[model samples]
Target: MTILIIAQLTIQETQRRRILWLGLLMAISFLAVFGIGLHYIVAELDAIDMDRENMEIATGLLLSAGLYVVNFLIIMMTVLTSVTAISGEIDSHTIDTILTKPVRRWEVVLGKWLGFVGLLIVYVALLSGGLMLVFYLRTGFTISNVLAGSSMMILQGLAVLS
Candidate 1:
């Protein structure tokens, strides 16, 4: 119960700071740039009457590249947003109040961990899902194992978060 409350507070604090909103804006910008680049590439390919096999290969390669970028962005955002989670509190002396409370030391750590994990999961989902959607719409194809691939990205973020 104490952990849950702390986790909830952490989430609210993050939301109040508009970090999530900023992340979304970053995601949208990435999608727009990706879409425009893809549009031009497709237009050029169509103009040259590229063969279906070559188009498929190109599309697959492009999808892989885009997904890689999405994963990288997710990790970067996660780390940047949560880097100061605990240290900043201590630095500001805000942690003194919380530590004086009845909350256990482990509870504080766990709560902060859970809160950031939840935030990162949502972040990864939105950015990765958006990337997949845009890729499908632009190329008229779907990549296999999206969730599996995204899980790897989530794990990557978690590894850094720890």
Candidate 2:
């Protein structure tokens, strides 16, 4: 299918980008630092007055904060990644090869958009899930609301790209 082809190309293109690896490494480092900081903060809160409601609130807040951080990173990466997807190819004369085929210009544009969207979805999903897991392990709390909020960020990113 056209969708699958576009998705595959996008994934391969993204894989070839040095920025992807750099962003990933930075995300991992940031998550580690965030986990350590959250652990200490939660420990301090526990010492103050450990209550179920307070722990829940703390967990939700931590998850929301982690999601926000990851969302920002994803948006930055997505924007940078997409900036050149089409323009770069055209500039390099590679668009001529594709245009010579049966594909229309709009098809190329839509394909690129779909591919980028797919890449963004996978990247954001993994990062968000990892952040959620880390926050859960650190605080023994899971926040569905925070997860929903983070997903909205991905949707927003898609809207911007479209």
* Model 1 per-residue lDDT tens digits across residues 1-162: 999888889888888776677887888999899988888898888899999889879978887888888888888878877888899999999999999998888999999989988998998898889888887898787778989998999999999989
Q: How well does candidate 1 match the true structure in TM-score terms?
A: 0.93
* Clashing pairs in model 1, backbone N/Cα/C closer than 3 A: none
Candidate 2 TM-score, true structure as reference: 0.89
Models 1 onward score TM values of: 0.93, 0.89
Estimate candidate 2's alpha-carbon lDDT, on a 0 to 1 scale.
0.81
Q: Once superposed on the true structure, which residue ranges of model 2 sit more than 4 Å away at CA?
A: none
| Per-model lDDT | 0.87, 0.81
Q: What 10-residue stretch in candidate 1 is worst by lDDT?
A: 15-24
Cα error, candidate 1, residue 27 (Å)? 1.2
